[model samples]
Target: MTTQQDIPGRTVYIVSDGTGITAEALARSVLSQFNLTFSRIHIPFVDTLDKVRQAKDQIQAEREKTGQLPIVFSTLVIPELVTELRKADALHLDVIQTFVEPLRAELGISPKEEIGLSHQNMESLEYKKRIEAINFTLEHDDGQSNRNLEDADVILVGVSRSGKTPTSLYLAMQYGLKVANYPLIPEDFERGHMPKALQPYKNKLFGLTIQPERLAEVRNERRPNSRYAALDNCRYEISEAEGMMNLENIRYLSSTSKSIEEIATAILSNLRSY
Candidate 1:
């Protein structure tokens, strides 16, 4: 029964032969399941023997300082480097080899054991599409412009602070979706319709709403005590926005309890359903 109280301040190291992004992401995802607080250290580009020795020294130092075995998540592709790293007195988890060895056995093939292949393809078509989608999403953010509204893969409509911008950007960057987002202002609600720019893209329209309380809290941080951040105003805007979406037969979801990844996945799922 390792409780949160048992580990006062554990050190977790992400060691990689490349940028260390993958190792860190994998480590964080696993660590989130535990309630204990951790001090994370990322040591990247351990491509040389000297760097590997340095990383091993750092891990050993942390273990000595904390009086606890440090946890190391490593994605080092070089065998010699991994062997050297293992000499450190820490719980070492090879992030890549764990899966790679099993897959190799099943497929009867050897791995290239290359470093940084995850992000090596810059001129790839998928990469170019993501870049273009990001540019399109930025250009069309918050009803700024509708120059190519019809080109958007999905157009998000919602009241302010309803998790539109981040979701849009994530959709674009991760899935190569051209996303356009527009705020549902009081004028649109009064006019009993969506924005003029969004009128033609009815098929691509998706809506996000949040609990009035949460919306107010998010807004209050940006503009304290203003009408825009008032709970009552949030309730009014959300009510009107939901009503308009219903009237227009547009699909909508609540962003109150969803992460950006979840929201984007849901949006993509709904889009694919059509």
Candidate 2:
């Protein structure tokens, strides 16, 4: 294979027209265009043409070190500022034109158009509401479980210490999924079905399982050197738990060697896909 190397001394400067973080964040996301690490400077909203002129001079100074400099404006909306930036010609520059430019060009829509908030955004808000409702139920379960479970977006079950609580909280706090979890005790494992309490909500339920060694390590954190934290106990619990899930024909995800964020996202995405 022929290997090619990169050019040296190449750079791109992204100067923001305003101090708003949103504008800076968007510009940061687009920095991959440079094919090199970039430098950023955020100029704040101002009232005077002299200040706008000065910002252009700063852009020119940054441009002197780079092959190209792209200036970004965020609701700066000042015509005088725009005029000054357009006239500065040391290097080729680009401004994010507007949200509607792509829409009009791609879909033949007019300049005064609105796309509304994306469906993902609306779904996110609903997900947050559901998670909040679920958290309230978990904190208050006090033998009064699942009065609000009917309202849960998802329910997770696994043996005790299999990361049930943290995983459920992570799902709620991050993806906004209302998650309730009930543990499967040994007696229930012997009978090989989910907790009768969960049977009523079977369709909404999901399961998590982990390797015995990992489960032992995790339980040790909460109870140092106790029999509950012993590897033998962990192995028995995990094997019985997996057997119970298999006998009941309940599909489950392995939580071993995965971070909480990864597990929660995979679970939510899997549920949505299903």
Candidate 3:
């Protein structure tokens, strides 16, 4: 029943003994639903007593400045470390203990609380799959190597810097997908068709396009004062690329205001349909 007017400015801290990615992601996912201004900070590698004390001191300072309790989201697996962080004057959300205790009771066994074990299991089969996917993604970047296009789970096509590379890498690393990306250039545009190399894997193809102004801005950072980065050229490429995608019945998405995570999820959802 909390309304936007009921929300107030606050501070949020994501504390963890490892990379802090889990704690931060949980905090953002929960906080994104509320309309409030949050000053966020991440305290990572707090695996010792000294680091815990330092983090507690920071929380105290922020509470004094704001005249209210700050909100803390933590994923510390060590009992002693979690105990120390709980002493801070804030609304502490123990992200791990919240579910770990129930699961431990259900299984009637003490949980082996290890830090970063979720991602550090390099010897596991899942880890090997992710590594292989990353290697395949790198080898086929930007249409450099098409010898293995048939092995790709998905092939991304778009004009240069339309988020093809990062999206492809994210798809590979996060989903264990073999992703290959190709950049559509003026030569392809002149031909008025999709790349001939991609015709064989038409079902695996997904296209990305961006606003011409935004595309030009991104390209200008790499090659300033050149025709390749000119706004008119960007506009022309986007127009032709989108037109070709539609005419060829290839699915496409716009990357103008969407995050890589959102774009990748959409691509995966589409892939499921086929």
- Identify the leading candidate in terms of TM-score: 1
Clashes of 3: 0
Instruction: Give the alpha carbon lDDT tens digit for every residue of 70-123 in model 1.
Output: 899999887888999999999999998889999999999899877777873778
**TM-score of every model versus the real structure:** 0.91, 0.59, 0.80
List candidate 1 segments past 4 Å from native: 1-6, 64-67
Residue lDDT tens for model 2, 1-274: 1122323333333343444455565666676565655455566553357876776776676556543444444434444555776555444343434654686699886553222222235357675685575566476232237566777777777877776777787776656666778777778767767778777777777788998888889889999999888999888887888887787767688988888877888888888887
What are the per-residue Cα lDDT tens digits for candidate 3 across 68-154? 788999988989888898888899999999999999999999988776666648788998999999999999999989888889999
TM-score, structure 1 vs. true = 0.91
Shift of residue 107 alpha carbon in model 1, Å: 1.1
Candidate 3 CA-lDDT value? 0.91
lDDT values for all models: 0.91, 0.65, 0.91
- For every model shown, the clashing-pair count is 0, 0, 0
